[model samples]
Target: MLVETVTLQIPEILYQRLVNTARATQRPLEEVILHALQTGSPPEWDDVPEEFQADLAALDKLDENTLWQIANSGKTSAEMERYNTLLEGNSSGTLTEAERLELMALRHEADLFMLKKTQAAVLLRWRGHRVPTP
Candidate 1:
């Protein structure tokens, strides 16, 4: 990995917190600061499943407005109605093959939607926005 060095200042309290953490963890201050920098920025998603990694990686480059939009967006009413109907059919074990395939596709889309929203919120919070709890 390429490394770059930049000089910067931090609040005294924040510096103190980093120093304290380093001491507690028996690590050098630089190591602690590097870890903090990496963690405080958008995630690398190393431990996440491969399926979710690409979506999350893309979010890291998005601007704040785009991230906020993603964080707040949800399903259309029509999509929600269809998804719910499919779920009901699934629960009752009455789905035809076509409906079953539709449900599977819808479920995957729903999963991706939720993952994007969550990642957007996390990035917004990390960027120091006041993300309200829902």
Candidate 2:
């Protein structure tokens, strides 16, 4: 594949960390950085589980307006309160079994929400909208 080179002004600490990671993994620095850029958070759906594929397909079907709405969706006030409560409990080492389960459920919900939002953003960009960087 043809490749283009671009210079980046990364922080010294970040650059060191990337170098360390590359050395530890026995991969070239450029390869490591390119891999990270290609497969960012909420990775491509090609190897995702079947259930997630369904969700991705659903998101792909949404119109631009609907995609915009999904992209802007965020956790409700109650959800935020619960998340805060869970964080407090975790910090105090006092999470009950039920609370732990609830926290896990909330985390799963947040992941799904983020996936939908990311997909929506990609769709909007595909439709020629100037989607802002997250």
Which candidate leads the pack in TM-score? 1
For model 2, residues 74-95, the per-residue Cα lDDT tens digits are 8889889989999899889999
lDDT of every model, 2 decimals: 0.77, 0.69
How far off is residue 35 in model 2, in Å?
26
TM-score of each model, in listed order: 0.69, 0.61
Per lDDT, the best of the predicted structures is 1
Report the C-alpha lDDT of model 1 over 63-115, residue by residue, as the tens digit: 67888999999889999999999999999999999999999998988888888
Backbone clash tally (model 1): 0
Error of 1 at 66 (Å): 0.3
Model 1 misplacement above 4 A: 1-41
Error of 1 at 40 (Å): 3.4
Compared with the true structure, model 2 gives a TM-score of 0.61
Extract clashing residue pairs from model 2: none
